[model samples]
Target: MSATENGWQPAPDLPPPSSSVGIIGWIRQNLFSSPLNIFLTVVGLYIIYKAGVPILDWVFWSADFSGEDQSACTSGGACWVFVGQRLSFFIYGFYPESEYWRINVLFVLLAVLIIPQMIPAFPHKKWLGWFFLVGFPIVSYVLLLGGSFSLPHVETEKWGGLMLTLVISFVGIVFALPLGTLLALGRRSDMPVIRAICVGFIELWRGVPLISVLFMASVMLPLFLSEGAHFNKLLRALIGIVMFQSAYMAEVVRGGLQAIPKGQYEAAAALGLGYWRSMGLVILPQALKLVIPGIVNTFIALFKDTTLVLIIGLLDILASVQAAITDPAWSAVAAEGYVFTAVAFWIFCFGMSRYSQGLERRLDTGHKKR
Candidate 1:
C-alpha cells in the first residue's frame, strides 16, 4: 500500500545534471573539453594578447591623428596624419579637385541603386536592373566624360585613384559575365564551328598570363593600328582585362553548367522549350546559383588585379597611395598608407564574400529537413 501511493517518477528528470546545463558546462564542453584543446586555447589566447596589444596601441592610443607632418609621429606609432593629408589623392587621384562633385554624384547614384538591388525585399527590381544595366552606364558616361552635355570635358586619362579602380572592375564584371556565359554555351554547343571558335578563343586567352595580355594590348595593339591611330590607355587595359577575365569566367560557368543534371535539360526539352528559352528559364538560374562562390572569387581577383594597371601607367588607388608616399613629408609613413590600402581592399572583398554567402544561403533549394 505504501509503495502504490508513492509514485514520484524519479524527481522529474533532475534538471539535466548541473555539469551539462550552464555557462561553466558550456565552457568545459567547448574550450577545455580535452587536454589538447585546453592547451591550444591557452596558447592561442597568449599569442593573440601578445600580438594584439601592441597593434591596438599603435593603431589607436599612440597614433598621430591631428598632426601636419612626420615630426608629429615621434611616438613610435602610426602617423595617421599622412593619411589625412593625402586622403584626397588616395580617393580621387589626378581628377580635378574642382570636379570632385561629379564622382560624388556617381557614388551617390550607385549607392541608391545598388543598395536596393541587394535587398531581397525591395520592389521594382526588374526596373532597377534595367536602369542599372543600361541607363546608368549612359548617364555615368555622360557625366564623367561630359563633352556633349555642356559639362566640362574630363578625359579618361585624368581618371585615377579609387574612382578608376571602381570603373575598371565594374565594367569588367558587367561585360564579362554575359560574354562568358555565351562562350560557355558555345563551348558546349552541338555546332562544330561555334564549338571550335569558342574553344580556340578560350584556350588562347587562358594560356597567356594577364600581364602578357596587358602588354600585348598596350604595346602590340597600337602597332597593329595605323600610324596616326590612337587608343585610350585605360580602354586598352579594360579590353585586355575583359578578354583575360572572360576566359576564366567562361570556365567557371562551364563547370557550373556541367554540374547541372542532364535531367534538367531533358525536362526542359520535354516542356517543348527551345535551347535559349530553356536555359534562360530553368538551367542558367540553377547553374549560376551553384557557382556563386566561384563567380565571387573571380570578381575579387579582378578587383585586386586592378592594381596591375599601375604597370601600364594607370594611376589606380594603389598607385595613388604609392605616389603620395613618395612625398618627402609622408615617405616615412609608407607603412600607414599601405595598411590603409589593405584595409580598404579587405572591406570591399569581405563585403562581396558576405553577400555571396547570403545569396547562396537564400538560393539553396537543395536543402532538406534536418
Candidate 2:
C-alpha cells in the first residue's frame, strides 16, 4: 500500500525556506560562507564605499557634460566640456568634414557583412564570407582612398585620430592571424631549414621593442628605399605591426597546437589524410578553440599598442586627445581627456573579452559538461 493511501497525506509540498534562495541566500553563500569570507566581504565593501562614491560622483554627477568651452567647467568634478567640443576630431581626426558619410557607409557595410558571417544559422553565409574576404576589401579601399567614380582622393597622410587607430588595428589583426598560423606550422615542420627559419623569424621580431620597429619602418627605412620609390607611412607602420604581432600570435597558436592530444594526429594519419589536410580538417579547429582567450588577449594588447604610433608621428586616437588637451583654452582638461580615452579603450577590449568567453562556451565540445 502506498504511504499516501495509508493516510500519510504527504506534507503539503512546502516551498523552500526563504534563506536558501534569493538575494539573502546569495549574500549568505558568497559573503558569509565562512568567518574569513565575512571579514573579507566587510573589508571589501568598506573599500568600495571609500573609493567608488567619489569616482562615481566625479565621473557622472559633477562633470560638465554639455558646454561650449572650459568656461562652462567649475572647479568641482571633471571638465568634459573640452571633450564635448573636440569629439569630432577625436573620432574622425583630419578626415574631410564633407566626406564623413563615406566612413559611415563603410561602417554600415561592415556590420552587414560581418554580423551574418558571425551567426551560424544565417543563410548565404558562404557567399557572405567570400564577399567579406574578397569584395569588401576592394569596396572599402575604393571608398576610403577615393580616387574613382567622382569621389575625390583623400591622401593617407590625412588619416589620424581614432579612425587611424582602428584602421591600423583592423589591418594588423586581419593579417596577423593567418601569417601567425603559417609561422606556427613552419616552426613545427619536419624540415630543418623551415623550422629554423620560422624560429629565427619569431624570435627576431619578439626580441625588439615595438617602438623600435615603428621607428625603423617610418623614419629610417625610407632613407634606404630607392629614390622615387614612394611608400605610404601608414602602410609601412602596418607592415611592421603585422610582422611584430604575428610573432606573438604564432606563439599563442603553437601553445594551442601543442595542447591537442597526440591521438588526434595519429587518428588523422590513420584516416589517410595528408599533413596539410589533417591540420586544416582535424587539428586546427580544435587548437584554435583551445586558445581563444590567448588570441583575444593579444588582440586587446594590439589595440592599446596602437597608441604607440604617436612616436612615429601618426596621430592615433590617444594622440588626438593629447593634441586637443594641449590647446590653451582646454589646457586643464588632461585628466578628463585621458579618462575618455581610457573608457573608449576599455569598451572595445571588454567587448572582445566578453565575446571570447561566449565563443568558448558555445564551442566547448563537451569537455566542460558532465
| Clash pairs, model 2 backbone | none
TM-score of each: 0.90, 0.86
Candidate 1 lDDT over 1-370, as tens digits, reads 4544777444445567777779988988988999999998999899889998889999999888887777777877899988988888888888888889999999999999889867999999879977887788788888887788678999998998998999899888888988999999999999999999999999999998888899999998888889898889998999999999899899999988998888999999999999999999988988887887889889999999889999999999999998888887655778899999999999999998888888778867773232
How high is the lDDT of residue 219 in model 1?
A: 95
> What are the runs in model 2 whose C-alpha is more than 4 Å off?
1-22, 33-35, 117-120, 126-130, 259-293, 366-370
List residue ranges in candidate 1 displaced over 4 A.
Answer: 1-4, 7-20, 263-282, 289-293, 367-370
lDDT of 2 at 216: 85
- lDDT per residue for candidate 2 within 309-335, as digits (tens), equals 898888899999989888987767889
Q: Output the number of the TM-score-best candidate.
A: 1
Scored by lDDT, model 1 comes in at: 0.88
Q: Go through the candidates in order and give the clash count of each.
A: 0, 0
